[model samples]
Target: MTIPQQSGTFVLVISTGGTIACTTDPATGARTPTLSGEDLVRACGTTEEVRVFDAVSLDSSAMTLADVDTLVELAGKALGDANIAGIVITHGTDSMAETALALDLVHDDPRPVVLTGAQLPADHPSADGPANLNRAISLAADPLARGQGVMVTFGGDTFAARALIKRDTAERRAFALTAPLTVPRPAPAARAALAGIDVPILRAWPGADASLVDHVVAAGPDGIVVEALGSGNVSTAMGEALGRALDAGIPVVVSTSVPFGEVSFDYGGAGGGASLGARGALPSGWLRAGQARIALATALATGTDPRLLLGV
Candidate 1:
C-alpha cells in the first residue's frame, strides 16, 4: 500500500522499543527490542529522507511513566523543528493507548504524531512491524492526517489518540476508538508531567469488600479509578470506602468494567452509583479504567480539577 507523499517532505521517526522492533534471542529464545529506528525505516523501503532517533529499547510492558514523559518531550521537540513534516513513533501495543492519550492531552501541535507497532517480533517470519511502520509513515507524511491530534494507525485504520483503546490482546487490529476525532487545537506551550504518583484501580467483583479500597486510600494516591460493575455499581463496603476517599479530597472516578457502556448514577442504594455520586464519586462517562486513570493523572499534573475534565 503506497501513500502519496509531497516533494521534499522529511519525516522524523522516533523509535521506542516494542515488539515491532524486537528480535529473537538465540540462546534464550526470548524476543527483545533490538532493532533501531533506522532499521524500521529501511524495512519499510521509504525513499523519503528520514531521521531516526532511538528513544528507548525495551518492550512496552517494561515502559514507565518517566518513559512516557520523555517520549512526549521528544515529540514536542520534533514537531517544533521546521525541517520535519511529521513524526512517527514505534511503540509497544501493551500501553499504546495510555501513552497515546497522554500525548494527545499535552501535545497540542497540529503536526501529525503517528504511533504504531506490531504483534510479532521484527525477526519473525510473519512480523507485521514493517507493514505497520509503512502505514504509520504514510499517515504521518500525508497532509490529510495533520491537525488530527496524535493518532494510532494500525491495521489500516486511524484512531484519535484520546479515543483509542487496546481492545484485543493478540489481534493485529488491536485498537479501536471510543469516539471520533474532531477539530484541531493549538499545541499547549507547557505539557503535562507526572511524578510517579500512585493511582490504584480497584474492580468491583462479586462479593467485593472495602479492604482493597481502604488500603489504596491509605496509600494516599493522587486519585483512584474503580472499575465498577454494570452501570457502576459497587458493593456496600467498596462504595463506602470510595466515598471516604472522595471525602478526603482524593478524586474517585467510577468507570464501567463493561467494554462498551457509559457509567451512570441512576441506582440509589447503599452501594449504588447514585450513592457514590452523592459522596463525590465522579462518573467517567464512557472511558475505560485505564483511560480514566490517564485523564485523572493528567488533570492532577496540570493543576486542573479532574472533575471539570471528567464532566462529573
Candidate 2:
C-alpha cells in the first residue's frame, strides 16, 4: 500500500546506505548497499511528494565519523528549510542509534527527524525496510512529532533519540529505549560542528588487570567510557587507570554494563563506583556504555563538562 501524496506537509528523506538498501551481487553472491534512495522509496510503496537525497552509500558498519558529521549537517540544512515539514533518514541499523544521538545533540529545531532501517537486506523475502520506511515517513509528517526531538521509529514504536539503543544484532525490533527521555533544560545551543573526538569504551572484567586500560590512556584520547560491572564497579587496576586518566584531565564517564540500570557511586572499594567518583569519574545514570561514549564525546567537543551535562 502506498501513502498518497498530500498537498501540504512536505517531507525530505535522506538515505545513507545500510542493510535496508542492500542487494545480492549477481556474480559474487555478496550483499552490498547498491540501491539508490529512490529505489528504496519506490520499494516502500510511497507516492508522497517528498524530496530525496543520497548522503552516503556504504554499509553502516563501514560508516565513519566523517559520514556522521556530514549527515548531521545535511539534516540540519533540510530542517532549516521552510518548505520541508520534517525529515526522514534511512540509515544502517548498526550505528543508527549513535548517529541519531549525535544528530539529537546538535540539532534543536524541534522538527521531527525520524531514522529507520531494516535488519535484513532489502532483497530478502521478509525484508522489513519498506514497512519501516513507510512508518518513518508517516511519523516525520505528523505535526505531533515536532518538539519531541529526533526519534527512531521501528517495530511499531517511536523512541526518543537520546534514549534509543540497539539491543539485538539480528532482531527486527532491535532498538529499545533504556532510559527516560532527558529534556535538556534551557535547550542546548546549536553546535557549530561535531568534533570527531576519539572516546574508547573500556569494559571491566573479573580479575582483569589495568594493562588494557593503560594502553588506551597512553594512546591519548579526549575521553574514556568505562563499561563498569554491576552498579558501576570495575577491577581495582581498571579503577586506578581511570583515576590516572582523570588526573591527566581526560574525562572519564562510567556506565553500567547491565542492560537496564542506573550507574551510581554507592559501593566503597578500590574499583567501586564510589571510589571512582571520588577519584573524579562521573556516573552516566542509565545510559549504556555506547550511548555514554557519544554523550561524552559531544560534551568534550562543545566544551561542556559531561558530568554537568549528564547531571551526575
Candidate 3:
C-alpha cells in the first residue's frame, strides 16, 4: 500500500494518534495508539519531504475540546508560516468529523488541510493505514486540493469536512459526508468560548417521552439537538418537552435519524417538524445528529442564532 515518493512540494503530516497509529498491547491484548508520527511517515514510504509530528496520542472517543483547540492552534501555525503545499492530519475515525469541522470553521486558507486515518491497527497484517495515509499525503500536495476547505481522505473518497458521519462501525470506508446547512457562515468564536459549552443530542424512539429533554433542560445546557424519527417527527410529549427547553431559553435543533435527505417541516402536528418549527425548534437540514450538535455548539459559542445557520 506504500506509495513511492515523487518530487513535489512538501506536505506536513500531523499525527494525532488513531487506529492508524495503534498497535497491540501485548500485556492487555488491547490495541492502543503506540506508533508515533514518524512511524506513520515511514510507513507511507514517501520521500516528498513530509515533515511529520504529533499533537496527541489518545483514543479519539476520549478527545476533548482542549485537544481540538491544540490542533486548531497547530493548523493556524502551519497556515501562517509553512511553505508546504498541504497538511495531512492522522486522526481516529471515531471523532474525525468533529475535529475536521472545527478546523473547517476556522479555516480560510487555500492550502488543503486534509484529515485521514485507518480502521485497522498499524500492526495488523492487512492494515489500511499506509494506503489511506499515502492517498492523503498525495491529496494534500495536489494543487487541485487547494481551497477545498478542510477535507478527509479515507477509503478512496475525498470529502469536505462539513457534517461528516461515521456510517459504518468496522468498515474501512466508514465515514459519510453530510451536506452543510450553508456553504459559508459566521466565523467561529474565540477558543475560550468553546470551553464549558455543552450541546447534547437526544434521539427520538418508540414510547420515548420528554424525560430525556426535561433532564437535559434541567442541567441548563447551551443548546440541544433532537434526532427525530422519519423526517423529523417526535411524540407529542417530547414536543412539549422541547417547548419547555425553549422556554428555558435554550435553542433546539431538529435533525433526522434517516441516513439521507434533508429535514423538512412539511408535517404539522404537536410533534411534527412543522409544529417544532412553529414552537421555536429549528430544523437541521442535511445535518445528522452528531454534526448537528457541533453546529449548535458553534452557534451558541459565537452567539449566532442557530436558526440562521441550521434552519432548513
Candidate 4:
C-alpha cells in the first residue's frame, strides 16, 4: 500500500517503527516491518477521507532526537492545515514516554496528537495493533482531546504525556500514569489553562551510566535523573560519577529502574542507593525515570534551581 495522493481529514500517521509494522512469515513465522504506511491505512478499513504518511521506517529503538525534531516539524505542519483533523504517532513503547514529553513541551498546536503502539506483532492472532490504532485515531479526532498536550491511549484510558510510563513489556495495556488523575477544565477555557502548563526535558536518558551523569553536571544542568539499578541504586562507578555531577553545580535525582515502586534510600553507604540521598541527591519516591525526567524538565523550564528542588 502507498500513501494516498491527496489529503482529506488526514490523520497524518507518522510511523516511527514498532511491532505495528511487523508481520509473520507464512513458513518461518518471522516478524518484520513487512507492512508499510499504506498497508496500515488499508488495514484500518477507514474511509479514503483519512490519509497516512510514511514519515519514517526505522524501529522505535532507533528513534533519536533528530527523529523527534522531524516529528515535531511534521505535526506542526499538519496542525496548521484546517483539513487535518489530528496526528497519530506509532512508536516503540520503550522510549514513547520520553518522546511524548518532548513533543508536549515544544508542540504548541491545539489539535490532538495521540501516540499509540503494540507489544505484539500485528500478525499475531491476539494482536493489539488494530485496537490501539483505532482508539488513537478516535482520540485524535476528538475535539475533547485538543489542547490536552500529547496523550497515550491504551486499555481504554487516556494518559497525560507527563504522567505516562511504560509499565509492562508484553501486556497490551502497557501505558500507566505515575501521577494522580488531573482533570482539566472544560474546553475553550481549558486550552488557556493548558497553555500555562510548563513541561521541560532537562535530559533524556536512553540508558544509565555515570559518565552521562558527569557530562550533564559538567555542562551545568540544573537537574538530572539517574536511571538507577533495582530499586533506585547505582553502581559504585555511577554513584561516584553522580557525586562529580553534583559537585559541578548539577542536582541529581535517583529514579527506580522498576517503573512501579517506592524508591528507598535506606541502604546508605558506599556503592548503595541511600548514599545518593545522603550525597544531596533527591529520591523520587514512586516516580519512574520517565516521570522524573518530565517533572525535572518542567521545573527547569520554569526556572527552578536543582539545589532548591532537591532540598540541598
Ranking under lDDT, best-scoring first?
3, 2, 1, 4
- Residue 166 in model 4: lDDT: 83
Give the CA lDDT, 0 to 100, for residue 57 in model 4.
70
Q: What are the runs in model 2 whose C-alpha is more than 4 Å off?
A: 1-8, 26-29, 180-186
Worst 10 residues of 2 by lDDT: 1-10
Give TM-scores for every candidate, taking all chains together and pairing residue i with residue i.
Answer: 0.91, 0.92, 0.91, 0.71
Which is superior by TM-score, 2 or 4?
2
Error of 2 at 257 (Å): 1.8
16-69: candidate 3 lDDT, tens digit per residue: 898999999879989899999999989977756787768899899988877887
Clashing pairs in 1: 108-187
Each candidate structure's count of clashing pairs: 1, 0, 0, 2
Better of 1 and 2 by lDDT: 2
How does each model score on lDDT?
Answer: 0.80, 0.81, 0.82, 0.66
Model 4, span 91-168: residue lDDT tens: 777788877766765557788788887788878888777778878888888778887878887756678775468877
TM-score of 2: 0.92
Instruction: Give the C-alpha miss distance for residue 96 in model 3, angstroms.
Output: 1.0
Q: Name the best candidate (by TM-score).
A: 2
Off by over 4 Å in 1: 1-8, 179-190
